[model samples]
Target: MDIWKNIIIDKHFWAFYYYCKRLGDKIWFQKLDDNRANLYLIKNGK
Candidate 1:
């Protein structure tokens, strides 16, 4: 019901996946960025 879930499930939504030479590095970077954004949301009590 949330916006994130809607985006994930929407037929109009298209997820783009990239192929990186170093998958571990990309995963780490993605997780770091996601965690930082989530931290901000939590701090703001979103």
Candidate 2:
């Protein structure tokens, strides 16, 4: 959970978030942002 929060708060994440937002890709952006929720899965290589 802490790692997930860290990822979401990362500067690169926000940069990508805004880029997708500016491109009118709310759904895609949301999906990408949602990836931050799966940090444990990622860290564990699941």
Candidate 3:
């Protein structure tokens, strides 16, 4: 079966989504300010 889905969303949102997918797991995101963000890896469950 094949289905088609059409939706509208922000480009930046998708960009971040793909970025996170690349990261796989263990990620901490911090929004410092508008148009800026920080991504850190959590190690040893810390």
- Judging by TM-score against the true structure, name the best candidate: 2
Sort every candidate by TM-score, greatest first. 2, 3, 1
Candidate 3's C-alpha lDDT? 0.45
- Mark the regions of model 3 whose C-alpha exceeds 4 Å error after superposition: 1-8, 26-46
Return the TM-score for each candidate structure: 0.14, 0.39, 0.38
Q: Give the per-residue Cα lDDT of candidate 2 at 34.
A: 53
TM-score of 3: 0.38
The regions of model 1 sitting more than 4 angstroms off are: 9-46
lDDT of each: 0.25, 0.46, 0.45
Alpha-carbon deviation at 11 in model 2, angstroms? 0.3
What TM-score number comes out for model 1?
0.14
Put down candidate 2 lDDT per residue, 1-46, tens digits, no spaces.
Answer: 3545555466766676566556653233333455453322222111
Off by over 4 Å in 2: 1-7, 29-46
Clashing pairs in 3: none
